[model samples]
Target: MVRNRELLSSGNAAFAGLASSFSELSETLDRLASVADDRTAARAAGLKARLEEFSAKITFVGQVKAGKSALTNILAATPGLLPSDVNPWTSVVTTVAINTKAPADVEGPTNTKARFTFFSRDEWDNLVVGGGRLGELAERSGAQEELADIQRQVQAMRDATKARLGRHFELLLGQNHSYGYVDPELVERYVCLGDDVTPGEGNPQTGRFADITKSAELFLDIPEYDVSLTLCDTPGVNDTFMMREQITLRSLRGSELCVVVLSAHQALSTVDMALMRIISNLENRQIILFVNRVDELQDPAGQIDEIRSGILATLKKFNIASDVGIVFGSAKWGEAALMGSYDGLSADSRKALEQFGAMHPELAGRDEWETAWNLSGLPGLLNAVAERVSEGAGKRLLERVRRNARNLTNEARATLMARRSGGAAVTVDFAGHSASSVMQQLAAKYESDVAEVCQQLRDDLMQRMQSAESGFVKRATDSLLEHLERHGESGTWQYDPTGLRVLQRAAYLSFARAMSAKLSKLYEDAARHVEAIYSAVLSEAEGEFRIEAPHAPRVPAPVGLGKTIALDLQSTWWRRWWQKRRGYEAFAKDYAHLIRAEANSITRDLEENQVASVLENARAILREFLKEHQETIRRITQPDADTAEDARKALGVLQAGTDTGAAFGEILRGLDDMAA
Candidate 1:
């Protein structure tokens, strides 16, 4: 019997190509490390090392019940994942992805307490059954319950399942993360990880299956494979109304490709027909159809042809010009083959199995099929997809790099715009910046925004702080006035809020400017971290992996953000405000100590003060116009924050670290002192 394994049972063609790509990337990084000017090669080597953590992304997604779990069980080539007893039937999306390995293993970002987490199998179950329970993170306390309780419930559900699924793969659930008490390891995965959806309660659910959510995406690592393809396993759209909504909201409109599956017993339904039309409407994405449960058909062979023709007719009805493939097989049958369960298997099921058998790159005529060790044809279909996606390699990577680079560049510009004491001609050298120097420069140039971002980050910490403060202030201010009113009413007593001393503490917390300044420093600290990432990118950019922009500097571009300047735009009201604020020098004296402290804070780590000095000057300017980014955003955002101070702080936490979403949330809670 062939022992099922992650790569062995299922023949993965993408594995070889992806592995080759990884090898090239690794070798290229190593080569740069060996000879590139300025240890860029070393930095690239480091990034490459980190990238290696994402070495094997094995996506296992399909429509409804396409035996994805069974396939995973077979491929994991292990027991207990999709045991035969609880096997093949999955309503939830499960992902067993990998976190970082080797060293500095900070892999638990998908746990509870994580503002951003992917769904685990159990979490997926809760979503599949409960719906919005997965997205409960944004709901208010309603009639007066602690929001934390809801979060805890979500986390607990996830944590319990994760403990059960303890594997190398990082369990990432998109769209649906709420629903459980996840562990610390899973919690940390979201620390600074950024997601496509801009945080808040995104895409909610309305029914019983409210908890059912998008699938979990896993990036796996096999020994020789380098660039791992992210594997995703989806829930049955037909089963849940809310899940269908979530899928439409998150993936449909933007999908570059989609694989549709129809069970043999359940041919396309009205709902399926409608979904087919929607997916077909997408001009950019291609949809591949799978005729699942083929083994269940009475005349499996004749039915396969009829099913193909039937699907073609159905596709025509939906105006989907592309012909869909009709694979007559079963995830259960495939599992049976992989597990060595043959004699009891039906003869027709075995024949249907052999048909799918012919599609597998590793199992064709291998005699393994006779003993039932062959994997599904799904791998072949997915590999075909990989080939299509990889055809134009550098183009996609370039776009991705450029986009990320531009975002970093834009923030850098925003931070530095304030420090222009005066300089002309782009003929100056920008090499030789030390790590400490870069940190200081980052802190110095964007200190105010950084501080604001930091303060905003204190949200969770600050919310309860502010919520408590809000309560105290309201009571104190109102009660104090009422006491004086009562004195008038009594005519015999002179009274004040000596009884409500708690208000005094509240009063102390009400100093907006002080809160602003404190948050400013916090933001600066956070920005320092963001700058570190940018600095890392730039430090690496000047050498081997250096991005060549559309202009002079070569940089990675995504979505084609160009130097006509988008993310890294050089001008914003914040910078202008900073210039005006500093030009006065009037408040400089009062702020002298704070400014110096901030400058010291910025300069502390730097070996040289000059680079820090230049950066500091920039920050001095941006601090004054702290409202710029926020002001514009508010016009576009719903339930907008009243002031830029809060927004800037929030932005700082997000931009400051690798886990942008989580950091934004964590930092937002931290600066609760500023909230209303």
Candidate 2:
């Protein structure tokens, strides 16, 4: 394991290297983007966007009510930084990182603040329209008498959505909705609670849209923690809609460490297990299962043991070889203990602790309480995180810097060689083929490859669709029908008409979400395929032309509405609402077919259109790359002194590993002098 201090040193070195490398690369890319044609400039812009700082992204994710917010608060050393409560409150991704305040003297007092991004009107509309599972709601609702209440809730949701959405209620809204930052004191206004917390404040009738905020980035200056650390407080994986899950997954992408906060009382919930499988099974990520709220358990040790055993069994069942580290802790108690003084503790928390101490006489002393707090498992988890981060972060940073530096150097060399040759020099050929022919072949190959890849993606989508239809869809369908069959009451049929419509809408929306999620997965897989193909094409193109260029990372497609397919179910069940449970069953059966068809249509369009577009765009990028600097390459017969000097400096930096930054000479001299 990397020691904390050493890790910090290496991490700093790596960061400095990246900062220097990016400074140069971004400058070059900016110039290229500025001069290039519209298409080329756009592509270059995408590549430039990828040149971000290599911060160790630590993501906290889990099922709803897993104490993640509380844990984030404790880690940030700001109790109210995130609103942690028993209620399932937060619905947006909140990222916390060190804020190096610019022009330090311009600031009054240094304090943490958050910048929030609200959802576009369209995004809010989607969530409001996409209702949840009818079977789940029915199971929870219980008793035929609750049907009236359920309808009322549905009507309330509709009313609230209209009232909050205002102008957007009648039409699909765009992303032009405004967003702003909150003052340090009002951070909670944006992050904590829902839109109901502050009604008529910013976006009127924002209750239905409370879950629509895009993200919140909290910037803080904490002394104990390294400034390089970035903690991502992701939304619950099981938040109301599939889009929310997409947001969470996107945040987790390229994260260095993923901490899944599990509730001790709840343990590995169904959604928690699903989330676990996603991060552990699919991604190459270091994971920590933080079993939170352990204080709620009577036998925390025994409970933790049981939880670990279950987790291990699940991991084995899933064929995951990684041994996930488990940490049991209570964020509430740990935060209090870390604060040292109880003055910051809430009255309820203090009373609860006092009652617990009174109940357990042996643990009455203050030291013992502190010990118990320590035993909450935060200290060990913190140490483990620090060590793991120290071990991995430096290497990650260095690799990024090295890659950028190498790319920049190669590009410079190519430019210099071409410039000296005077647009006539041809050092090499592309695999025995001319550059023009090779470029043409590449375009054709990409087209063919996209078609073939899309076919494979379609097949995969169909297979997954079959599995989901059999698994989640069938289970949800059968369970609801069985419940309805068991509770056959014709007198309650009067209450059924409106209630059944509400339920049918909910059921259709649920099915649509399921299909949408599957489609999202397919899109992601297809994106990966396109990325791989693009990389392979770049390699081939470069090898053929005998030209070296900086290997810019594959630019990802931006998150947009294209990933989702809007569904408006036909009015087959609207007239049959009086038929009660049988009507709901029929509606669901018809709706499933519609959903399956929609899924297929969406996937086909993605396969034919989106996937092809990505490949074509990638091919265009290669073409642009060649066309952009070919003249420079051709013009170089012999290197000028200045050109040679610049190339030499770039090559020297590359040769020296580019990880030493500006202090490399000083360090090297010290080493040499010590040796002498």
Candidate 3:
């Protein structure tokens, strides 16, 4: 505020300059998209990259009273996320992301649990008393004390949820994390709690009648698309007092797609109007206008045309398109469960069929359902979101991206006035010994080995050098663990490093990072060496006739042949979550038993050290691969530096010291000194 005021009092140069630059940049972006200046060009490039990155984030939004949640469920072809008890359950604005992979792992701020962390119908009976842990423990144990014996109650509940917790879902553990929501930073912090948490009753403050804690977030790993989709199911808008302001309004800013759900009974309201205002800014975004709870207005025979016209007019006034995008659907995700259609509906089916269609015609039209029994009415909504997301966001990426980059030469004109207006200013002079010679020597050494390593890896690995997920998981976990130790109850607002445990004990995550970094480096070394060797060797063979370059005999074969890393060691969901359940348990038990039974098995096979044996096997594999592809080998040990530079330019390769992970880079810099 002070800065804003000062700028306001002075010539409106600061803000005005920004605004003017913004206008120019916007126009420049419309015409010329790239500039020569590093910072400006980088910002534009970065924004364009992000624009293409989140192209699949489809959001369902609306007012508190609007049936956004219901419509989201309807679009998803499910019973829906929150209860449809005419309440405000979307308090927190949950975002459900779904990927192509099987839905098994669920992450939260506090824990990373798998599918078992979720609950089954029968299992829920024993776990919950009141909605919250603080309340449930107090009510179930018959305690009326100032502070509920939280630890004891938590322990008991933990026992009840033992089989399910680590089995079903994974808990991420923290205040900022939510279930079903996975950020790259949070993946390492991901504590795999199972999915079997059995949901009983959650808070009924809002119209929330049911709890789908297990289904809180949906993460689908669609390998076919090489993409993951997360669908956030927001808490009811009516429940928490903190919700009245609206977070969807804030979060929907960069959304590529959104669904505004309105109830047929209440076509539009003040709350709905406020929501539209937020969405109005996103002209580039696509929204699915879903009218939910058509049951109340089932007699479309009487009000169908009127309701349609009302909706159409409202959309027109708001400049929203009117088409099949506006559909009447049910907010109920599991109507079959509520309607009792599971027992092969006969009598009830006959009586409620019309109401079912009237209430959820959207489901009836879906390919997943239309079985007359609504056993899978939910599939329609889920598929619709995916379909619409793909279709709606199908615009040309290069064209839609419009952040223009101005010519770097314009800097001269823009800043020319700075000298004339200011005339003279305070100046400082520094005289320090230059370390050019030392820098030259250091640069030479780095350019010799590290540079070679980087070039070799770049030619071979491209973007595969770092696993984005694994990298992010480690960083995010470390960050959150630091946050926890700094603020968690056990630490009691004090982050201490009094003894050996200080830095080492920041969070278990620190140790995890240490391990992860070590593994990454090891794997990186192997992959880089192997790839560099292969590419370098192969390229040497390809350019055998070129007399300009020549070096030592470099084997073109795969680095380590039969000697391969353990297949299970790769970053995988099975290793992360599945193994924890049936696979992990079986492997652990069987391995333990075998280790006990066959004392000589280790000596014979593993030496019998399993880990070491796996590495040896990997090496063998690489060796054999090289022997087979011997023609592809390059005999050159190290290519000439000058020629390598020229080749890099020809191949569009350049050493880009790009560090967008600002925080990560800072940590790396700090660690570099420690490493040295």
Candidate 4:
């Protein structure tokens, strides 16, 4: 177990660093923005927005029916807040935020309410018409059966939506709208059982919640914990098709830690392995492998050992460098036990417990059962998570904020240098050419060099992206096509989500995994390009001037870019949600074209815009140097007192904000405040 004192100290230290750094950086940027031109101000605003958007992400991931929702309840310490019995196929991403301080606007004792966001009508129509991108591609390739299956699923979802939503169905499809302040008492009414479509008088019984809601969020004050925590309950990895899975993966990219829930009965299943592999690929993220339902095992200890060994072996085989903390427990028993109501267990669960007791007469007593139930490892798990958050996640978040501050500090220093050195500009005559002409020639040469490096980078990275995109899409398309070709109409929907739509869902998962790899590569490639460009530009500029651009920070891994392509591509409703803007028929007819077009568009967005943006920023550094020399000489020679005052004020603002010692002092003070 992580030491509580260590965790507290770490949290205080990290939070202090973050608060002070951000405060200083924000002040400096404000000062800079006041004096900067419109273009520079806009760019600074963009950077500021990015920094402000930094929030600690915690993602919950696991396989279908692994009691992930139950685990969520345990983590939140709010039993039954989320529907534990929700259909796994409906991949709705739910988020729960615990406030450290109660809201001033709210009247009561930190009341919990959920705000549900629904999908637009256009998105649903697109999914119906296009049959999703993979389905459409399969259809075009003469895979009639696969297309028909997709059409059937679409029709089923549409029919279910109408039956469940009734008149309200139309209300939800309009746009990205919110339905909020829903009482905690009726949380289940909004999230549970996708097919519960019966309409009631006052209570909205008829709601296509699974179909409509893209995501839901719950906010409440948890007075127990000292630190604020936001927990995300995501869809099971194999719950839906490709699209929602990708969304979950994209969400994971931002998360500091991932708690992977696994069922003891089926430990390290294929889908579990896939999900584990995904998290392992993510750099600088912590992981916890939680094996739920351990109470069901005949020999819990032996089974847990076997499960752990298997997981370790598989992770090694996959070459994942993750050190996962393994927790063995039963989410069901733990939740019920925590609520102080063992009778809350379903009749089926009660019967199962009885059978287990009968199987082992030696352990058949209320005391043993109580101990078993309490020994659900719930307390230990919570403590571990909190420690990790305080020790690792908090520090990482602070470090990222500091990196942004450092970058801004470099910018401020360069601007100061420009202002100070402008008066001492040197001019030289070279080979019958004027100093300005020679400078222009040098700029032109470096510009070409910059362009060449950028182009080569684009060529290499874009090719890799294109190759992966094409191959994965084709493979996914081909799998569905072949399945249809092989088993025309024999597939049936089973009670288990993994059983129903198995072929298509499996194909979707495979494709999603491929796309994730592709996306990770794209981010890695872009980061590399950014670093190379900055280094090259800095070298070239150093030859002429002392001013240089800041080193590129470790860019966060880019996810969700493939999400820009044609459809949700997931077996779930994300495809429906994503296609909100396009007409169904047009999307369907040109689905393949749309897929290719979207891929190209994303590639261009990254290869052209993103790469160019950073390089352009680098060039701005060089331009600033040149401009500084030119302006300073003119100002010094003219000796305008009024202009000098304005410059001095700007310089003063920066100097006050950029005091390293003062900032560190504030950081220390902040730590003291946290301790207090």
Q: Write the per-residue lDDT of candidate 4 for residues 275-371, one digit (tens) a residue.
A: 6546654443377777888767766655667887887787676544546667777877665655656666676655555554464455455564354
Please list the C-alpha lDDT of all candidates, in the order they appear: 0.38, 0.49, 0.35, 0.52
| Clash count for each candidate, listed in order shown | 105, 16, 132, 12
Please write out the lDDT profile of model 2 over residues 39-84, one tens digit for every residue: 3346546655555433567888887768787777766666655765
Candidate 1 wrong stretches, greater than 4 Å: 1-15, 37-39, 46-66, 78-92, 98-227, 247-257, 281-286, 323-328, 343-348, 351-365, 370-376, 392-395, 398-547, 550-676
In candidate 4, how many clashes are counted?
Answer: 12
Better of 2 and 3 by TM-score: 2
The candidate maximizing TM-score is 4
- The candidate with the higher lDDT, 1 or 2, is 2
Best by lDDT: 4
Per-residue CA lDDT of model 1 for 1-676, tens digit only, reads: 4334333414346545555555554554454333221223344555465545443332333444455445554444432343222111223344444332322213444432212334456645555334342222112112113234444554664554455345522434343344223332332222111122344653211111212223333333443222343333444444312343344324432233445556766566654643453454332224456555666666664666676777777767654574443444565565565556666467877776666555445645466743244334445554544554453332244333332333322432322221121211112123775433444454455554644443453333234434543443354444434654555322221112222222322322333334445544544454345433444433222211111122111111111100011111122322332333322232223223222232222122221322233233334434432332322112222223332333454355445653433322332232222121
| Order of models, best TM-score first | 4, 2, 1, 3
Q: Evaluate model 1: give its lDDT.
A: 0.38
